[model samples]
Target: MGNVIKMDVYRMLRSRSTYYILIGLSFFLVFLINNSHESLLDSQKGLPVPKAIVGIGFDGNLLSDQMSLLQFFKVFARSQSFILILAIFSVLFINHEEASGFTKNIAGQVQKRGWLLFSKFICQGLFIVLAFLVGLVTVLAAGEMSYDEIVLGNIGQLLKEVGLQFIFHLAFAGILLLIITLIRQAIVSLLVSVLLCFGAFAFLYHAIDRWIQQGLGIPDFTMNNYTITGIISQVSIDSAKGQLIRAVIVALIYGMLTVGLSVTIKNRRDL
Candidate 1:
């Protein structure tokens, strides 16, 4: 397993897309902060601020002028842009082996073929963490340079939020891995992942929730509450203990189930 992981890391380092994604994310963060700074200047000069800047908050409320480091982190973390970037990266990264005809050679050499899939999943998780840190540092540096008084509020709370976001994101990557493994097509996987990031299946989830509620004779049984995306949307820095616990549970369940199914398929099927 360790050897497999090392090889995966080597491939990741050799790939240009890996660095491209991270570089793009940093530029995106800089753009966001620049826009926010311009909006702040406009508001101070008694001019109208754009609706886009006004709606930057997670709750669709006006962004506070005194944006704390925590608030900036939350805004970036909650946005689908981060997940979308990681999804595309994972799809391309996982598909590269099959596309380059490297999978056949690697599968024959490994004692347990399933370890290859597992190693890829583990490496994806590591990349997700690295991306998270990159975004965090970008936001901190950009915020300091843009704003006059950005507070460093509660380091513990900030770390907790970062940890929760990482788990949720890793689980999301697992879902994409399962899709890419089953479909074996990068384009199709990318389309599905983009749709998921944009909440394109929201209606489907709502319909399922209604059906389950009617079947169980329950007034408020929502399937979304137990879904990974739903859990992510509901969680926040000020979320209650119960909500946080539910988020962790849902993330773990989805992550484990998807990885397990993908590994089983890989082991039982011809490579």
Candidate 2:
């Protein structure tokens, strides 16, 4: 398992796409920081009413507040949608290997299919950690440079928020990995995973949520369970503890189920 993980990490680091993504994210942070300031100050120079409306609508809290780490980390949460980076990396790491016949070659040598797949999961987790580190450093450095004095919020709460978001990414990657492994096709799997994560799931979840809300007069069910939008919202810090707990439980369940499915398919299928 260690050997498998090492090889995967080596390959991932060598891939041009990985560097491209990191470079792209760096530039994205620059853009986000440059334009993230509040327009309320600008309103003082012009029409206050219109600027206030614009400021309210602008989703640039990470740049505007500049103090809280949660706000800083919200850049990826805001811009990456629910699964953009995770989907791309999982597809490249898992589906691309299958498409190129690398997975089959490795599977022939590995004794346990589950262990092999779990190693891939570990590799995915490593990538997530690397991404989180990059985002954290970028935000903190940018905050220090942009704000006069960084006013941090609750440290414990910030850690919890970041940890939950990391878990969400891992869970989402597991789901994508299962789909790619089952389909065993690169382009098709990539498109399907992206659409499912980026839009399809959200759309279906929202429809169900709205129906439940209308019929049952429920206020918080959708916001608390498997709802990508709710999880990514900047205001999630203010959500009830129960809601966050439910979201984490749902995410873990989804991740475990998908991993089990992948192992089952690997064991039963001829691949």
TM-score winner? 1
Local distance difference test, each candidate: 0.79, 0.66
How much RMSD separates candidate 2 from the native structure?
4.4
Best by lDDT: 1
Task: Estimate candidate 1's RMSD in Å.
Answer: 3.2
TM-score of every model versus the real structure:
0.88, 0.78
**Candidate 1 C-alpha lDDT tens digits along 13-89:** 78899999989988887777767677667777888766443223233232466777677777676656577778888
The positional error of residue 93 in candidate 1, measured at the CA in angstroms, is 0.4
- Give the per-residue lDDT of model 2 (tens digit) for 17-114: 87676666655665555445434244444633221121112354334434567666665554543366667777777767766888778886777766
